[model samples]
Target: METSIPPPKRLKMLDATIKRHQYQQDALIEILHRASELFGYLELDLLLYIAHSLKLPPSRVYGVATFYHLFSLAPKGVHNCVVCIGTACYVKGAQVILTCLEKSIQIRAGETTPDGQISLTTARCLGACGIAPAVVFDGTVLGHQNPELVSERIQGWLQNGTN
Candidate 1:
């Protein structure tokens, strides 16, 4: 998916960054941030390269990446949508909202639209059960969401590029 940037070129960039950071093990998170920013996602190849570059085990790199919600392993679309599927949210029609989103965006859960404009994701819980049926567009959480309002907000993002 990162075909736009050649792997060798990315490695070269990583090498420079590692050298600049002095390859300190503590810079792992910063290195990861750089890698993610450069490549748009942290693929295994990128993580392995980072570990090798930093003289750390691949597992450590992966552990850090997976531990933080700020990091994403999969490529994201221009816009991100994470629907809550926790029990409380589900009971409040979160699944209906998700289904409507899938239909409207023409992408199933865990997928980005063909146009690369929308990524549909699911979270077991957003810890906003009090609001139930929450949807996060980009990074802002919308509580008490219904299908119509979610669709309207998505349309707004499609038209305006912000939510």
Candidate 2:
């Protein structure tokens, strides 16, 4: 789908930060961080804006964004669930866990719910292998997940925001 790419806007606060840092190339990371915070995700226009302001190439900005797993090109969900697909989690049946979640939530990886309440995705590793079959809701990690428990927990989050 071809979405409209809006023109870039100059963010005064980010401009000031860039100025304070003397527009150092190293400051790109910091600038992108602030931009992500302001806009929720690193949209293409925002990337172009940063590139123009910093006199950097759009490709360079995109490269840095993609290099970091924390940066997302798409809009984030109000609620997010990240299941770990690391070897440990996989061995513990994380695939089954993810399948149950997909069925219950009715959204696949890299997609948000129709109401935009949740986005589901899988991570290569969360570095918490001791707790295999782990899923992270928002930023909180839930370990040792079973299918029923995963469904119930997601439902609870939708209904009560307990997660």
Candidate 3:
């Protein structure tokens, strides 16, 4: 089941921007980005708010969101881990690494931990394919990962209050 997320004050600011621009259709992506930045992810209500304020259909807004890989529909945890699965990383066993992470964290891809400590996800590429099997934690990239090493690193981070 999905939980309700209150509309953040940032949505009001986005609304103003949309209105100021006379609700330009071209601004949809920017508006959605701003909303995601404010709320951590695009909640359903927030998407509807943007659609209503911009006079666009919610389906169009959702399509734009899903078309781009950056937008997340679910709430993110305090620490976000994005593992790259591009061709370079995949050949280096990135999929195995992700499975290990799921075992350790008990949450599958795109799911947050029960304690809200971490969210695990996969990306097509982090643009660091040279460093195959790359993983990003809170914007810091750690490349050339071994599955065992990745688990240890996550444990260390949680233990050290990095989460």
| Best model number under TM-score | 3
TM-score of 2: 0.80
Candidates sorted by lDDT, descending order? 1, 3, 2
* Per-candidate clashes, comma-separated: 0, 0, 0
Q: How far is candidate 1 from the true structure (C-alpha RMSD, Å)?
A: 4.0
Estimate candidate 3's alpha-carbon lDDT, on a 0 to 1 scale: 0.83
Root-mean-square deviation per candidate: 4.0, 4.9, 3.7
Residues 1-163, model 2: lDDT tens digits: 1124232333666677788888888899999887776667888987897888889989999999876756778887778888898999999999999988888889887677887788888888999899888999788898998888888878987997444
Q: Per-residue lDDT for 25-109 in model 1, tens only?
A: 9999998988887788899988998888888999999999987665788888889889999999999999999999988888898
lDDT of model 2 at position 156? 84
Candidate 1: clashing pairs of residues: none
Per-residue lDDT of candidate 3, residues 42-133 (tens digit): 88888888888888999999899876767889877778888898999999999999999999889998888887778898998889988888
For model 1, state the Cα shift of residue 68 in Å.
Answer: 5.2
Candidate 2 has an lDDT of 0.82
Order the candidate numbers by TM-score, best to worst.
Answer: 3, 2, 1
Query: TM-scores, in order shown?
Result: 0.70, 0.80, 0.87
Kindly indicate the candidate among 1 and 2 with the higher lDDT. 1
